[model samples]
Target: MEILIMLAILSTVLGGWGGLNQTQMRKVLAYSSIAHMGWTVIIALINPNLMILSLMIYIMTTLTLFMTLNLSSTTKIKSISNLWNKSTPMTMIIFLTLLSLGGLPPLTGFMPKWLILQELIINNNPTMAIVMALSALLSLFFYMRIIYVSSLTMFPTNNNLKHHWFFTQTKTTNMI
Candidate 1:
């Protein structure tokens, strides 16, 4: 249990640091994985019996969604900004992933939280459960911020003045 806790702590710190430091979109998602896995590890310490199942479900869903995102033309926020005009499917998936990460209902994310909360309640660890649940609200803020940026705004006129090389490549390749 102690080992798991320590590893979780280490993973979260490393992942958070990496996510914040890098500009590459893939690395950011990689870091997000580290941080999220950290949470699963920590939670597992409190609820050992259910940890494996929770982790399995979380990892599967996250990786699957990320794979879809990776195959997508849009990777970074800057690229995502230009996406409103490109493909609606890409835009919608990003929005859905954001919502899933925020643990909205009917998504895979809701399952883990539901299980975690149930475990917490069963363990009679109401305080920890409440704290964890409330802390989720903070995560929601960041997710909502991303969603708002991706889905709500029109592209800046000034951005049009800059020609993205990648866009040219994509166009050229598609033509061939």
Candidate 2:
């Protein structure tokens, strides 16, 4: 069980790191969702009774986050550097989703983690609880970086920009 958990966590970390570093926005979110799901699975494995509940909640939250990201036409941090300046509504949604994804309290996203933590404590596994807490913190860092890239700065307008993704989005929207 521990080996499986380690493998799941490793895959999520590598996948998110690779996708985000490559500036592929969708891939980053996709991989991030994978990582989050992994944590949920770890919690569930220890408490089989709560598996369905946690997975269901995670799925719903993942769907909402993906929809928000899709609507913004942003696949990478570089594509939406000036997101707040370009579209305030999208920026707000993105920010809210990131906060939720990070499992901030008072949001729907907090429920699964809260349940997991409670289950862990009930199971009397302090070591696993600590690992889960650290994993949540690590995931938060990446989500915050993505948020920073989108809202906290202007998109660089220059030829040296490595990604040409926004042009396709612009062209499609113009056709509409």
Candidate 3:
């Protein structure tokens, strides 16, 4: 139990501090995942069932993010800065997804974090809950940065590149 607590704290801190200087969008997301995993681990110490739920939610959100990035061909922070110029709808999706991943209210992402925090407090571990909350703020900072770059930046007017028409594929195929 003592070791788990220490690992939880270490991971939370490392996840936040590690992403501070990352220019690659993937790296930022990876660190954010680490931080979120730390939260899951913290709760796992008290209840494994809750941890499973949290991990599943995290996986779903990450899958959505990676798929969006893959479709947009965005790998770095700078590449994503002009996403609004490429596709407004994709940009909006990415923005909302990142915000949800950041644990904003009324999103699926918030549900697990809320449950974990509640569990922590109920389990008589207010100190851990406080620390986790603070670390979460650090993660939110990066998420907001990504959101700003992807949605708030202006498109370059001097570019001569032809805009590609985006079409949604209605055909669903089995991957298996």
Considering every candidate listed, which one attains the maximal lDDT?
3
Instruction: Judging by TM-score against the true structure, name the best candidate.
Output: 3
TM-score of 1: 0.67
Q: How many backbone clashes does candidate 3 have?
A: 0
Error of 1 at 81 (Å): 3.0
Global lDDT of model 3: 0.82
Give per-residue CA lDDT, model 3, range 65-121, as digits (tens).
899999999888777767777776787778788878888888788888889889989
Instruction: Rank the candidate models, highest TM-score first.
Output: 3, 2, 1
Backbone clashes for every candidate come to 0, 1, 0
**TM-score per model over all chains:** 0.67, 0.72, 0.85
Candidate 3: C-alpha RMSD after superposition: 6.2
RMSD of 1: 7.5
Error at 64, model 3, angstroms: 0.5
The sequence of per-residue lDDT tens digits that candidate 2 reaches over residues 86-106 is: 565767777777777777788
- Candidates arranged by lDDT, highest first: 3, 2, 1
| C-alpha root-mean-square deviation, each candidate | 7.5, 8.4, 6.2
lDDT of 2: 0.69
> Worst lDDT window (10 residues) for model 2?
160-169
**Which is the better candidate, 1 or 2, if ranked by lDDT?**
2
